[model samples]
Target: MASLAAGGVVIIGSKLIGGSWAMLFASGGFKVKHYDIEQEQIMNALENIRKELKRLEQADSLKGSLSAEQQPSLISGCSNITEAVEGAMHIQTLLPHQ
Candidate 1:
């Protein structure tokens, strides 16, 4: 099992569930790695995360002490699974139902 760096969370997937999980962790002040095989999906996920964070901030419901900008700043997108999981303390993988 891989371990995250202090306050690190690795999200394996860039779909709705994975992205949401990443945002949740980031909002809670965790360093998040948003990973996806498709770069486009990763980009989309990041954009959506930014929007959601802003919404939370505007609603005064954002988690943790970090601002929306700061929270999103803690998340990084990666295509490589190994790199994404490198220093994460927790890993969340979202898989589509077959």
Candidate 2:
């Protein structure tokens, strides 16, 4: 996981898929950038991630060593796709297929 500290992940889209991925990586001690066109979506996603993390903690199903409170802190919401991708070691896109 030391490599994860050297570089972060950019997750495009703030829907369920993207948010889930963000939480997954963050729980693993990886920094995560969450991108969404709509600010509302980003806000909602953040809230959802928070709730999910708590639930995981309660269920004792959370991955990695980070606590629930610590995991969400690793994710940042970014409105700009370019900005989110910048300095990211890996990128995951959750856009729907056309």
Candidate 3:
């Protein structure tokens, strides 16, 4: 699927893959907010994202040609559903199908 270049939020769940996905979007210059109901998962996701970012830096695959300092600023964590959705032009619900 095509990315939202205008930038938006992404709601993620328990897996590091969610944060990984968020990283991909953020790397594309989109602002991403990753949300997990569990606090531990949120922390894990953020850490995972950082690791992925480091991998990207090593491989030289980040988007917008951002400098190393500019990469970490792309994503943030959200504690509540409201904060996650607020100010987001588009929302990517990462929940699996039932």
* Candidate achieving the largest TM-score: 2
lDDT, each prediction: 0.84, 0.89, 0.71
Per-residue alpha-carbon lDDT of candidate 1 for residues 8-96, written as tens digits (9 for 90 to 100):
78888888999889877876677888888899999999999999989989998888778988988989899888888886678888977
Q: Which residue segments of model 3 deviate by more than 4 Å?
A: 1-7
The better-scoring model by lDDT among 1 and 3 is: 1
Tens-digit per-residue lDDT, 59-92, candidate 2: 9998889899999999989998878888889999
Query: How do all the candidates rank in terms of TM-score, highest first?
Result: 2, 1, 3
Better of 2 and 3 by lDDT: 2
Single out the weakest 10-residue window by summed lDDT for candidate 2: 1-10
Give candidates' CA RMSD values in order. Answer: 3.5, 1.2, 3.4
**Model 3 Cα lDDT, one tens digit per residue, 41-82:** 877877777776777788987665665456557777887888
Residue 31 lDDT, candidate 3, scale 0-100:
75
Which 10-residue span in candidate 1 carries the lowest summed lDDT? 1-10
